[model samples]
Target: MSEKKKGPYKQTGNIAVDMVAACINHYEKQGRKVAYIRLDFIHWTMFKGYVLEQIPAYDLSNGEIEFDDVIVTQGSSLQVKPLYHELVADGKPKVYLMN
Candidate 1:
């Protein structure tokens, strides 16, 4: 039998916002929550290693940013436990990633 591949799946779109949104949406559709996101150097350069709580208001488009890449990981694993970014919302901590 052929085994299915686990991924550091490539997520891409015309803009950084779109790529991020697409990664979140992809997981939501699969009934999985995103645990963390890993950005390639190209994306890291654009966002400067920070992912904002809100999408940017200004156009953050440089043609070079068009193919921005990210890998979305879901579920819990020792491998990913150290990568979570904690967000405190309504006195509750939510774990997600920007690593």
Candidate 2:
């Protein structure tokens, strides 16, 4: 019998960012068409500031920002923590791929 394969996950100081990066990588690898990434727990003001700093061409009117070929949307922290916890419970590594 074959045992289930365990993870060789990634890590970073910000687990949220790491999770996003991982998801992007996964989707990209699968050649999937990603609509957008919703980031929860961040305020609109902060999200706008972050976008301005990270993506100069981002326009808030559209409520979407593309970074490294991935479209992202502002979301709430409450929604994000549970996903992070799921990843952690699955033994995902803490790999940091975001600035």
Candidate 3:
């Protein structure tokens, strides 16, 4: 989903390296051999009700999806996250979805 909002900086989960492996899986399935993933993020938190309506699979413990890569940004907060990838602070191709 495309997001035109803002949010404060927040990260969730362990930001484990296992997610990288999953991204590799998707890339392999697509035959693109994913070199990297672009995670967009907006400053918005998802409510339980909204999660039920939008992402029922959403795990409150780890609300993020793991793919090839992820990025995080800082801005105003919202009622829900409308973006996916922001940008890795290190400037590397990899992204870590923090909150």
Candidate 4:
């Protein structure tokens, strides 16, 4: 018999759900709530499909992955990093996924 997979990866067959779940778990451990999620344009092109497909699969009742604001930007690290810092400085709980 096969053993049940642990954590968020197997919770949903969708990889986006699994990634978001893992991110939520990390933020929750730090006593933070994710209100914003940013994906740089290059990665977003590949990732957005998975994310959009899994939006309906999000388990918001658990209150872990509560972010409704998503940002996708096209720019160098110089441009993206500052925006990320600004969000953090403004006390907005955020997750930035970049390559």
Q: Rate the local accuracy (lDDT) of all candidates.
A: 0.39, 0.51, 0.35, 0.43
Query: TM-scores across all candidates?
Result: 0.34, 0.43, 0.23, 0.38
RMSD of 1: 13.7
TM-score of 2: 0.43
User: Stretches of candidate 1 above 4 Å error?
Assistant: 1-14, 49-99
Better of 1 and 3 by lDDT: 1
Query: Looking at candidate 1, what is the lDDT of residue 54?
Result: 30
- On lDDT, the candidate that comes out on top is 2
lDDT per residue for candidate 2 within 1-99, as digits (tens), equals: 012124533554355545655775675566564455666655334545655765576566887655445556665545743222111123457688987
Order the candidate numbers by lDDT, best to worst: 2, 4, 1, 3
Model 1 clash pairs are none
The residue-by-residue lDDT of candidate 3 on 1-99, one tens digit each, is 113113322233323222333444444455454433433232223223333455576554544433323322222343243333332244447767998
Give, for candidate 4, the lowest lDDT window spanning 10 residues. 81-90
Global Cα lDDT for candidate 3? 0.35
User: Model 4 lDDT vs. the true structure?
Assistant: 0.43
Mark the 10 consecutive residues where model 3 has the least summed lDDT: 1-10
Ranked candidates, highest TM-score first: 2, 4, 1, 3
Backbone atom clashes (below 3 Å) for every candidate: 0, 15, 18, 0
Angstrom error of the Cα, residue 58, model 3: value is 35
